[model samples]
Target chain A: MFSWILLSDKKVHQAVADTVHAVTDSSAHAVAEHGAHGGDENLFTQLLHHIYDSKYLEIPFYHNPDPNKHGFELMQFEKWYGIDFSITKHVFFMWLASAVLILVLSWVARKNLKNRVPKGFGNLVEVFVVFVRDEIVLPNMGKGGLKYLPYLLTNFFFILVMNLLGLIPYGASATGNVSVTAGLAIIAFIMIQLSAIRAQGFGHYLAHLTGGVHWALWPIMIPIEVLGLFTKPFALCIRLFANMTGGHIVILALIGLIFVFKSLAVAPVSVTFALGIYMLELFVAFLQAYIFTMLTSLFMGLGMQMESHGHRH
Target chain B: MKNEENNAAGMIRSVAPYLTLGIQIAAAVVLFLFVGKYADDVLGTKPWLMVAGIVVGFAGGMIHFFREVVALSNKEEHERITKN
Candidate 1:
């Protein structure tokens, strides 16, 4: 008796194979060709020559091992999503960065609280907090900007965490994934559009979409402007995605250099680029987060500004 | 003198609006090219979608930039009227 497996270079291939083998109480070898039967790599291909198929077990991260328990084994995303999204590793990094940021900031916030004077780390963070509030959010968003501060702050910190996490050796960058960044951009897009409609009535917001052109130009401009709405958020998605991915790829390639050259001597030179890129990535982590938050504020601000000014009549 | 203030403000109004748009456009193009390089590895269909995505992205950026221009002018006019 034997077990069967699917052979593909896909990431889940191993997991699927292991599952099949664990279930079947049989020993099977992967076959490249079918027997005289004109069958392909279907269900009955190679593993059917078995008696029983038992369930495969995995080492748990931490578990009580039951579905009703706090931590269970079958939460494997690879099994469920069928795509190796590396979500756990990414989440681990995200949590690490968040934990660090919170501890440090909270310590500073606690230490710096004063009746009159601010000092040290508190002073430093205040500078950024104020800068983001004044330079980033206020100018674009206007007075209503105050309302969006919590969201803007959350965006800033979350992205800052994700970006910084990518710099760590074992950490996966969550923002490097298109889905994560896309989800963020969509949130920004919806907030901007919804607020625009609320601030300006639906009629005015729709008119804004037409770019205030003669009705003739409206035909072309409206579609373009509507496209623009999606494009800004889409650009937001790609910017964070590419920046994070690019840094990681560069670092990976630099490290790969030693392997490619097959020489220990190349290690020193490769280390230089790797270190350099990593440092740049550190700055980029902060910059990208700032840029994303700043742009979101700017868009939301513009919409609100238009609504207020347009209604002043 | 007040007119000069208005001119400077108007100038700022003109330049500031374009500033963000230009940056966004440039950024989008750079990112499009960067992702396009890895399209085959990610999407499994090679240069076709990547090339198309790049073209579409560039057009989108340019169009958005133009729209911002019109919007800015409209905004400036409204601000001027409100001042009066």
Candidate 2:
């Protein structure tokens, strides 16, 4: 089923590309007829023409003009059963990250589970797992946080892998896409609400939405509380996506300076800056993954904390 | 000794919420402004509903923001007392 979808998506992409090319070609012809002859084309006109003729940069989530021409291209389905089932680059990377995580973790688990002392890669994985459980999940969620270890651990590693993978030469960061981040945030949000409901019971959970205010003030308080729910996840989504996308944009823009100047003199400076940004991006990749996971765990913990159970104002 | 270790861990965990607070406040206000605008368009009330949206959104966002700040302060105070 997946293979068939992939095949059909490829066909759809081809059709879309063909359509774009045809439209551009017609426009170019119109311009030629109305404005500039081949020899008489001005520098600006020539530049515009070049831009038009140049294949669009093959970003992961976007449509590419040529699938065979290398770089990342999404298999566009256009529309499949009233929904677009196009397999984009981000989706592919997400799947790859999941597969890689499962394989690595399962191997680590097999090795470490049987041994009193793990060595090498298993040791490394153990260190991260322990750090997350002790420092992030346990501290935030208190004594009850142990039950949430699996979810938080999985989240941290998945995000870490996805972020790190983007630093690779040809890999795109799935988390850089708003939709992917939003999806993760939604899951976190649901977990948070579930934790709250479980801890406080349904009545108390709904009561807390009044924020301990008088019953008469509920109309005003309710909207604010509800907004609070969504704003947290929305912020989470934006924070991850923006951090990832911002770093890439900076690196790309710095590199584009070389082409813009069209001079070898600028190449060294541009490359140097781009390289620096790329290195910073690697640090940021890990930082963002850590931040996202930490925040999600904290939010979950907060939800589980009874309003009256915490320190009184 | 374990409590001391947990205290340090708690300190670290506390940092994430502050990082997100500003963004949350701004998003809340902006979201409500849009919501208000949409409501005005749908209801044909023009400026009144839009004005009400801006007021309500700002008030709610600020209230939430201040509440979080207070909660954080209180938690910090409690932690300091316990540590002492």
Candidate 3:
């Protein structure tokens, strides 16, 4: 058994090193292991706890194995409808992300009172604003999308910040949580439906659910279409959750390679590869935020376009 | 309110088709399969209905897939021709 592991060590390392698999679907195994690995408080389990939402914030420059001694516990906030409502680290990080953005937008970003042009941070902020306006909102959604720009812009920056939080020291990524992503998806879904309803009217919206099919097939078609309506945002929720989670999985798996081999020789190589994956995680942070925003606008556009153009290819 | 990444999104616009196509294909099958499973639970046919659901779902999913592929290819070809 040890001989096989030794022989295939380099080969398995190559597989984990590829990281494309790790960056995508393989992250699920990382999450699935959370349930399967309840016994030991090994490295993988610790990594899972760090990535997963918990009731306490991990304090900087501190390490504690005992659950009770570790981090500032927000504890349970409230319980409604059988679900435990707790203000955990993920929630704290999300709020922190929002607060930081709020400060940047409100006070620190305003350096252009005297000059016509926005200077420094404000200028940097302007570039993104114009880019989103001209490139994303106008192109995909057109003038009609201008009304929804505030929501779309908030969606973009909020998600971008949340994605970035995980990369920073002692910060948890709220977007990695399915529940957080689901909440965002739900808002996006509402906006998409609102776009369709506003453009097409109430009666047309209901009629469209029939899929222009005969009344006899309405039972099948309506349910299918409604499910289809949900699946778009559902796709958004799952993609963000999985991509972020997958990144964590790849990192854990690479770190796990050392424990698997039980060798000090693997440490340098494993750490190097883990560092590379970390860089990729940074790119993914932005990519995911972009994908979510672009897709949301595209869906909103498609919603309005459905009626005006009569069909989409 | 701040710099978002619509500009970057333009650079990666081509990536969208790749993401959506698989989901479109799978979604049809999954949704149909779900309806079939619910029906099976009520009707007590268990495996038989689920088996039928799988077949139907695959057929339905494939049709959607082919149609989407054709449309995408046609659009791509049109763009290639028009670019020249």
For every candidate in turn, the CA RMSD to the true structure comes to: 14.3, 11.1, 8.3
What TM-score, over all chains together, does every model reach?
A: 0.60, 0.75, 0.75
Residues A1-313 of candidate 1 have per-residue lDDT tens digits of 1123222323223343344235321121121112212233342424322111112222223435464432222223455466564334445555676787789878877877753467777887778878778767776677777888878887888898888765653345778877778899999999889878878889998777766656865544555566557767787889998988877677655654443333345657987887899899999999999889877877787677776565321
Off by over 4 Å in 3: A1-43, A62-68, A256-264, A311-313, B1-26, B43-84
- Residues B49-68 of candidate 3 have per-residue lDDT tens digits of 87787677666556555655
- How well is each residue in A58-175 modelled by candidate 2, as lDDT tens digits? 3433443564443344466668679867776677888899999999999999999899899999999999998888778876788787888898888999999999877775466788
DockQ, each predicted model: 0.09, 0.43, 0.13
Better of 2 and 3 by DockQ: 2
Q: Pick the candidate with the highest lDDT.
A: 3
Q: Write the per-residue lDDT of candidate 3 for residues A66-182, one digit (tens) a residue.
A: 645555557675688878878888888889999988988776345555567887888877787787888789877778899999998899899999999888756678998999999
Error of 2 at B53 (Å): 3.3
Lowest-scoring 10 consecutive residues by lDDT in candidate 3 chain A?
Answer: A26-35
| Candidate numbers, best DockQ first, in rank order | 2, 3, 1
Scored against the true structure, residue A299 in model 3 reaches a CA lDDT of 85
Clashing pairs in 2: none
Which candidate gets the maximum DockQ versus the true structure? 2
Q: What is the TM-score of chain A alone in each candidate?
A: 0.67, 0.76, 0.82
Best by TM-score: 3
